[model samples]
Target: MHETVTVAHDDAAVVKMADLFDPEPATWGLRGDPYVWAALRKHLSGKDIPASLNEVLALLHAAFDELVGLDLVTEPASSVYREQYAHGGMSGGMIDLDAWRQRLIPLLTERARMRLEA
Candidate 1:
């Protein structure tokens, strides 16, 4: 069976997304994943969500750049992870984790931000 989850479009919901970084064990899974943790910290700041989609996209872009700048997701590391996955190891489903951080996430987050804006 497939389960459906829905989030209401409101500041409270946006704030909940931002609160994923709250350092509790329940939310700490992403904390050990360097790329995701850093990107989240860079993008979601303060207690309130911004008022515009452009601002949200800008934050996401900034977060992506910050993750790259930090070297948390390095090409060499990504290559290693890719090789492991190819050899049947579970490298979190991505052939390249860095590529996911640098490319896909910003694209997806921007799309979500646009939907939230609407």
Candidate 2:
């Protein structure tokens, strides 16, 4: 049994939200994923967190879609090629969309919730 927590959308709250990725995730979907995450954090740092969790989710998803050039929710289990983020020898600039939706998004959401409780 869990109660819904209302997320704060103030400057401090949003700063904390964006800082969730400060240390970066332990694992990534592909070589360029870290670059995408870096870009994603920079992108999010400027915006205000929405009041509702759903809106927060939408905000994150939309940012990811914009930076990755594909919507993870509708896209199939495939990788998107990004020349701008290419650095590795193989699979450079290729990002795993499934990992973003399944791993990153949920991780951010959970971090948000934890922040609320703290």
Candidate 3:
């Protein structure tokens, strides 16, 4: 007998989403969290999609966490976010997520710069 496993995020799905966020119009690349790739991969999991769009969205929301760890979203002509903010970033309780952002930003920036040069 053989153990079974599954793969996810077939080439077409990544290629399509990558196209949406590609850094260049004529070239292919991706922006946003590397975890997006991870999340996409996990969600695909080579299993068939469920029967509902809501189900899919819920999965995405769960797999991926916040970007800046706060309501980083901005809207023009409006100073308020209509949606109540939730910590996609936090699992336990209230913590200074913004402070963590301040600490991580510089380190990630340096790493990205090094990658660009390499």
In angstroms, the error of model 3 at 117 is: 45
Ranking by TM-score: 2, 1, 3
Best by lDDT: 2
Give lDDT for model 2. 0.79
TM-scores across all candidates? 0.36, 0.81, 0.27
Regarding TM-score, does 2 or 3 come out ahead?
Answer: 2
- The C-alpha lDDT values of all candidates are 0.46, 0.79, 0.33
Best by TM-score: 2
Clashes of each: 0, 0, 0
lDDT tens readout by residue for model 2, 41-68 = 8888866555567877888889888887
Model 3 residue 20 CA deviation (Å) reads: 13
Q: For residues 1-118, what per-residue lDDT tens digits would candidate 3 score against the true structure?
A: 9998887757653222222222322311222333333334444455433334444344333433352233322212211121222324432222232322343233323333433344
On lDDT, the stronger of 1 and 3 is: 1
Clashing pairs in 2: none
Give the root-mean-square deviation of each candidate in angstroms: 13.4, 8.9, 14.1
Cand. 3 TM to true fold: 0.27
In angstroms, the error of model 3 at 7 is 24
User: Residue 27, candidate 3: how far off, in angstroms?
Assistant: 7.9
Pairs of colliding residues, candidate 1:
none
